[model samples]
Structure formats: C-alpha cells, structure tokens
Target: MINRIHIHLSLLVCTILEIIPMPISFGTYRPDWLLMGLVFWNMFHPQNMNIGIAFLYGLVLDVLLGYTLGMHALAFSLVMYVASIHHLRFKNYSIWQQSGIVGLYTAFHNMVLFWSQHWLNDAFFHLNYFWPIATTMFLWPWCFWLLNRVRRERLRH
Candidate 1:
C-alpha cells in the first residue's frame, strides 16, 4: 500500500542520516535519528512496525556502520518492544509528555549501545556519551511534528 511505502521511505531516510559522517568533535552529540524514527513509527503504527522490522532496520545499520551484526538489531528490538507496550497510552499524551517518554526511550537505546560497545570492545564509558540522548530529546518535538505532517499530507490519500 502507499502508506506502507511511505513508512519504509521514512525509515530509509533515517538510515541514511544515521550513517552520514560528522566531524568527530561534534559526532558525540548527533541525535539517533534512526531510533527516533523507529520509535515514532512503532508507537503510531504498531501493526506496521514490529520487532522483526526493527531488527531488519538495525541489521542494515550494522552493515552500513560495519559494527557487530546483531548489536543494533538487539537494541532496536528492545526499543520497539518498549514502544509497542506503551503505544496506546503514548497516543493520548501531549507532545511534551510524548517527548519526555521518547527521551527515556532514546536513553535506553543509547545505554544498550554503550554497554554493547564496552562488552565487545572494552570501550570506556564517559559523560559525553549521554549527549546524544539529550539532543535527541530536544529534537523530538520537531521530528514528530514533521513526520506527522508527512503522514497526514502525503500518506493519507
């Protein structure tokens, strides 16, 4: 269906943004665009966005980023699960409330990535690592509004 294609296209754009290189100095602050997109679609369209879809998207990201194959897949699966659990309640909340929940979701995603990296590579955890969660939270309102607009104006035909 056209709506399904629109959803996939939005995900594809998120993947593209996720891998786009940034200067190393500012890279730590880059929002998790893909995770944000995943949360949005999973929360708003639970039937269309499931754990399997999250895994597939995360697998693509792993291949693109050349990380361990299942790392992101696992994280994304968990994020989707959490979103699916609260989707109904989240739908009725104001944008600010939704963004607050999204902040927690983003933090959980980051926590998974951080622990996985430390487990796989013995990477050191630092305060700077939390920056992305904050940035993603700050950006959630805008991202939600734009994506919602697209779904309404472009996918509602």
Candidate 2:
C-alpha cells in the first residue's frame, strides 16, 4: 500500500513538472518528465504500473495540458506495454545502455504522438518536435537513479 502511494506520488510530481512553464528559448528542450516517470515505474515495478495506469495518467495529462483527449493515452499505453514486457532485459543493462534503449522508447512515444496528431488534427511536422527525445535520453540515467533511490528508501521504511 505504501509502495503504491510512493509510486503514485512520484508520478504526480512528474506530471506537475510536465506542466510547469519554461522560457521559450529553453521550452523546446524540456524533457518529457512524465514519460520518464512512467518508464521508470513500468520498468522496475511492472506489476504496480501497467497499461491501464499509463492510459489514465495520459488522459489526466491530456486534460491538464489541453491536448487532444486520447493522443497521450495511446502513446503512453504502448510505451508502458513495451517497457513492462522487456523490463527484465532492461534491468540487466548498464545505465548508459539503458539510456540508449530509453531513447528509442522515447522516440517511439513521440512518433506515436506525432502520428496521432497528424492524423486527427493535421498537425504540422517540425524538426523541433523531436528535441525531447535527445533530452529525455540525456536525462534518463539521473531520472532512473533518483526514482530508484526513492523506491529503495520507501521500501526500507
């Protein structure tokens, strides 16, 4: 019960971070914090964080961020599904290698969002749209370490 609360609290914090505004110059470089959180929880705690939870969080994000209702939900569900299935493999890799794989996952997540937006809303393709992938990849190690620490500390209590 406590473990679940900690997980949800961390995810909620990530969601808050996702919505926090940045200066225009740096906004494009903002990492997908919530996506990283989802990846972390799904990878290390798959039984606790699954596709349905991802979908719900994505829906909450969509509503909070004023995006089209289901775009994030679909993308998050797919990413969570993939991460949950391969988590054991992911856990065995070095952090750097895991970061690379996470980059791919982030890319896939962005691709799904782009495709859905383009199909449903005729969104324009922009080179800048993919910037978050690089940032997310660069930040993955720290994110993982931090979340892992939190999980460990909570579990020990």
Quick one: best lDDT, which candidate?
2
Q: Cα deviation of 101 in candidate 1 (Å)?
A: 0.9
lDDT of candidate 1 over 1-157, digit per residue (tens): 6768889999999899898888989888989999889888887789988999999999999999999998999999998999999999988999999888988988888889888999989999799978988898899999999889978887556
TM-score of each: 0.95, 0.96
TM-score for candidate 1, please give it.
Answer: 0.95
Q: Flag regions of model 2 displaced more than 4 Å.
A: none
Q: Compose the digit string of candidate 2's lDDT tens values, residues 1-157.
A: 7779999999999999898988889988889899899988887788888999999999999999899999899999999889888999998999999999989898999999999999998999999988999999999999998999998998899
Q: State each model's C-alpha RMSD to the native.
A: 1.1, 0.9
The candidate maximizing TM-score is: 2
In candidate 1 the C-alpha lDDT for residue 149 amounts to 90
